[model samples]
Target: MTDSASLPQDTQSATRPALPVRLKAGCKINLYLRITGVRENGYHELDTLFYPLSEPSDTLDIEEGAAGSGLTLVCERADLCTERNTLHKAWRVFAETTGFRPDLRLTLTKGVPDGAGLGGGSADAAAFLNFLNASAGKVALNDEELNEVAARIGADVPFFLKNVPARATGIGEILVPCEVDLSGFTLLLACPPEHVSTPWAFKAWDDRYANKMDIDATERLTLSAHMFTRPSSRALWLFNSFESVVFAAFPKLRAYKGSLIRHGAAAVVMSGSGASLFALYREMEKAMQASESLMREGVKTFIHHL
Candidate 1:
């Protein structure tokens, strides 16, 4: 048996705690997002800040599956239940690479809204990877190796590999630890019913930005460790490139941002692409009140804090 200390601190060893394990794959809100230029391969480069929500939106209840060659994944959303999802795909790769039959059964409770730009899908996938890596008796990949596989699985998967906040670049794969202790502030996220297609949003962004050479995609994004060291309403700057195009298509989302501000948010912006709008504040009371107001008007909302 290899000592866990000898292994990376973030990964599992031959011995983990008892089974019937349950974990939450928390979603993320983009504190700052800027679209760089499109890659030669057609993937767009981006600069953004991904802050993990304190609340775990998706719950993964894992136990040994019926003796089988593969893993079983169950979810409420029919669209997400397929192997096409990040969780299932990650499991398959782990199983094949390890030659270890992963007879794990998963009961996933989906609290995060899909296509809301909240990274709900990525969160679930990351949670599964982390839990499996930690709980399985035999280790397949260390933290670095796991990240390489995660990067290939999805752009957002690597970010979810660790729960901390990060400054991301390079098509959302490059992650650097940029911890901003936002414990004192509350983030109120209001997810509207409409879902925005990220691909469409990107196309729109390209069309909009293609003409603007003034905006330098290569300009070094300057938010560093010192900037987010404290917990304050203004510690982090707020921006998202998707809002310009998304707000135009979804007027209700635009209106939601206005309402949160009118209700006393220090700052408000869309989370990633469209539909999900979040407001930052120093007081939980004001955040709750604002959420309640949106709830009264029939909007799905979530409150998170560090």
Candidate 2:
């Protein structure tokens, strides 16, 4: 066993090339998400396909610490630190699990918009944890262990660790890697400045479905086998259980999706529970044109080909 604390001063001081690990964490769009049922433990059982998109993302950098006891974090956004920071929580859990006595300095460069349903924070945390685990030469935690810790931090963290499109179940932890090809398609993401509480979205869903249609049936068909056959199939299959709940509260988000359709998007849908909406275009030129138009309209937008 390699003891992180007992190494000789000379050995530790012989700088190992700075080891400044930088990782690009991808964002996701919930192509289809269904709230199957509520669990006894209060977590909702869900079925969803987490589609990785070539859009906005956050970058993380980690370097060996000079002399410290706990991890230190600096962020591009000043308000992002403190006890509520997801990266901080990930660092704490990793430190406790590996006993590596890490003196790490982490820097987060935020490009993803806050509360846009793009899983920005989750990506940052997962990337940071992975970088730290690799840097320390510790046994890599399997998917199960990684997800267990991820769920403790946030619902979206585990999905980022997978870093690919997957059909996720059980509060979004169960992953079935999909072989969907999005090579030529470009994604246009537009997010208006706003925030939506996940808990509140769930609560609104319960109220809306109290006497409504069957949610399971509506959601199940969208995730059926036919969805993987073609890119255009996504136009019919795009469904998010939180959309109704979110749209009822924030009508502008719904309008944004409509605008994407009018702007030549093949398919448009809300990314997660609330504000960010995305349009998938068959061509990169069209996507870029739409993104530029949205930016001029004062919406925060990103365009990328996946």
Candidate 3:
């Protein structure tokens, strides 16, 4: 097994003694996720609306490294320091594709929790990719090229490259900018202690709905061009297909959603797959009250005014 230290390196670090660049890796919430279809490659197609969240973000501090240092990653979480991490993979692959390898050291402080369907890892990788491109001088990749590289890194990494409200399709790689005005709404995000594996969640859905795959094709075709425009249709739009299997596997998540609703959330739904639930409120007071109520129950919470 080749460790990170054994990866390729260059002599650019000796001359490029630049200042540390700090970046905030923001998280995203899937306002609605529908598994539209499954491909022959076993990748599930999705029709989901992704809304960027500013609060509950991770921080990345990157600086130029010494000569022949390659890429060194030091994360607050030990497990993320490995080559398997998206950050390391981003650096490695970006270098391989563009040949703009620079010796650098990065320290990541994670505020977003993993395994909570928050897209924390993908956000981090996207941030790092942007950093690399910005610092790449003349060898930088363009927006389209960067997005292709981002997609290769992860299905959702390309979403964070722009980090705005987007409607995603085609295995969550194809992004279409959508207009979602949540100006007066406040989002109360609750993260439970339970950690849900995304792979397990998808497999569970496949097993339970093996025969019902074709049922969603019609809905996807009808709603592919739909936007969050009408107020009356908000209730119908506030849905996640993974909730059926995820809530069944983890009953506490369903109970938490009920708590958020009881505390006066206008709408509550699980973000991506499981382990985290968010509620929207027209009133800031109600959102804060719901946050306090969930916190009292030992759930970690974040309040972001959208």
Candidate 4:
């Protein structure tokens, strides 16, 4: 986990007059990721499609308190429940811009593991913001305003607001609906025992593409709506810009991908700058067998139906 100690201190409260509003924040995998260029604002311009999954989601129970009571967060992972927390950061932005009621608390139940490139933290924040918009009419912000709030928190925050299949650009905030129908497909996600920091991933990306952005002819692959509409097409288009560099660092993860493919996976790609790898299969039995094989290799695995 590239030592979070250096990352800038990057959540919620509870109280009266309402039942706790529980919300589920879905996790996602990038079907394709492309770094088109770097923007002058210091954010990498991206072209990626997000595919949300139902199984691995974090749950949040939010409750509002008296005004000026401030925000409080309760979680098993206190390190992730602080001001640097995306939920806390999103709350700060939303409350400041929208004049939201200050006192709030959130009990966060984390199901999605962090640093897996699943956008778990961003999704948790987005889910809470959705709850605030629907329940707190006094602090109601329109979709446009809400989008801005999400962008302020993280690049992936805005995308998780819609929480469906989307083609995202502009540092991953700009979104357009994309067709990614993975119905009946089985996904086997294997996490090697490690984490890759986002900063490290980006620096690696830049270093790899600095002088020769098209180092790999495959890096310039174009995405189309029709490519994600069916399983066959989706398999053909599966790409992640981080895979080459990341796999070089973690050969076990790379080997896992190859193993899954050999075990009949139609598509296997690193989800992000990942320590986690996901493989899609047409049959659950094949996925199950692959999981057993991976487990024998000491890589943790989970099978999910798409």
Candidate 5:
């Protein structure tokens, strides 16, 4: 592994003349997720499979130039400004780790809806970190270090660093690559015009059904390899442990899933905690048609072939 700290100081100067580095950060969907219990630190223990989507909403641009310099993130979403942007934190971390501060400006194109359970912010942060590693010729931080920084940002951050289908556990930091093939499938994502608070959803679960359900039994359920290889077999096994709790609290999400099923999706399920629902189609054309049909019905949709 190349250590960024050991690299000559002149490296940044050599790469300074090039144009800004741009990377497309991809979004992810949780194929199957379960919250087993809450840890002493107040974090939830979970087991989930994260599947990366081909098309992503946001783009990060890193242009070289000074250390301690600020960032300019251009996006139509006013909420994604410098102060609250994940790109800002990414830049700060990069500078702190690499010890090279080049004058850089970032532009985030907001195609993914915020708080939609799509891991958009995680993608942006991971993309920026990776871009910095390349442009600065550092290559110092290995996968483990990169993942450590990601976990510092959010529970879902580590998944974006791997950027592949993975089985995640332990507050979503531990990851194991899964050999699931989605090469010929299409995923249709629908982001309803509402946001569900993750913390609130968890609290609602604890309040209404903590005593009624066995979280341990739920965590013990596992998918067979054959089911993963065959979509038909897997469709019945695909589940999100958070859905029933969240759906009961927010009836609109359940209705959204119903709408997805009514529009010809092979399987419809909520991604992550709530607000965003996805339907899987075996064919791309069918997924595209479903997206258009959903849009006509006033539901915001994003379609991608994985």
Candidate 6:
């Protein structure tokens, strides 16, 4: 649960870390996610809250390359080595916008799972963007300008730039700081083998709730924020809009959530679209108890004490 601020600010100092810079790109959990509407362009508008997690992160080792060497990305994971990967997009976009393309080589080690609805890829891209901007010196883009460039990478990329709890709206590019304290709670996350597609989740939701799409968007947005302000209503806010559609398609995921509750979780909900579930407990003992229970069933789990 380290704050994003804990990341290297040494990049700002005249004495920067030597040639090879190492950065940890963490993932995120969507505490509350609701689809408010779908734009004509087919992008879904969301009212969601993002909370960063340090575990299940990807590591990036970067070093300056010879001039005219361009950017070279190497990853053991074949899928991520492609030019279409978000990291490549981030580098290209940042360079086009800032004209500060440094010849560099990046090596990525993935600890996060793809399509787990954990925003792992987005986090990696944002981390790279921050590093590039810091290295750009006088050509560095300001926060607002950087966010605009990040949006081009992905909807969730901008959030990782600051990596704090935030309420995101309008296709997830817009962000505002939102603090929801969980000082005495423990978070236990269970990642099942299932990988849910974001596009499929949104389309399923649309087909199922098409008639309800025209409902008052403003009312829902106001309530989403207000729910966090009241501690007693926190349980009610643990809901995710994608669950109804996602669970119906993956029965095993539904059963896993039930198992978590039966094991003493105060509250449990699937993170983001699907494939991962996180539970909250008032005590770490209870969280550990739940973690062991799920692990015995052969499910991968992570425990974070807040």
Candidate achieving the largest lDDT: 6
Model 1: weakest 10-residue lDDT segment is 1-10
Regions of model 3 farther than 4 Å from truth: 1-17, 214-234
Local distance difference test, candidate 2: 0.71
lDDT of 5 by residue, 63-109 (tens): 54456565666776777775667787877777777674557766667
Ranking the candidates on TM-score from highest down gives: 6, 3, 1, 4, 2, 5
The CA-based lDDT of model 6 is what?
A: 0.82
Which has the better TM-score: candidate 3, or candidate 6? Answer: 6
Per-model tally of clashing residue pairs: 1, 0, 0, 7, 3, 0
- Would you list the C-alpha lDDT of every candidate in the order shown? 0.74, 0.71, 0.82, 0.74, 0.70, 0.82
Candidate 4: residue 136 lDDT (0-100)? 50
Alpha carbon lDDT at 72, candidate 2: 77
Give the TM-score of each candidate. 0.86, 0.82, 0.88, 0.84, 0.81, 0.90
Cα lDDT, model 1, residue 76: 72
Residue by residue across 1-306, what tens digits does model 3's lDDT show?
Answer: 111101112222333224576778889999988777777788998889999898688888877788898889987678889999999899989998899889988888999888899999999998888778766766778788889999999999999988889999999999999999988888899999899999999999889864555556676455432422223113777788788889899999989988888877888889898788889898999888888888888999998887
Candidate 2 residue 298 C-alpha distance from true site, Å: 1.1
Off by over 4 Å in 4: 1-17, 64-67, 213-234
Which lDDT tens digits does candidate 4 get at residues 1-306?
111101111112232124456677778888877676665565777788888876577877767655776778889886876789988887788878877655877788888776788888988888877766654554577778888989898989888877769999878889998787788889898877778888888888778764544334344333223222233223657777777678787777778788988999888888867877888899999999999998998877878876
Candidate 6 stretches greater than 4 Å from native? 1-17, 215-234
Error of 6 at 119 (Å): 0.6
Per-residue lDDT, model 2, residue 123, is 83
Candidate 5 clashes: the total is 3
Task: Report the Cα lDDT for residue 94, model 6.
Answer: 96
Those runs of model 1 whose alpha carbons end farther than 4 Å from true positions after fitting are: 1-12, 135-139, 211-236
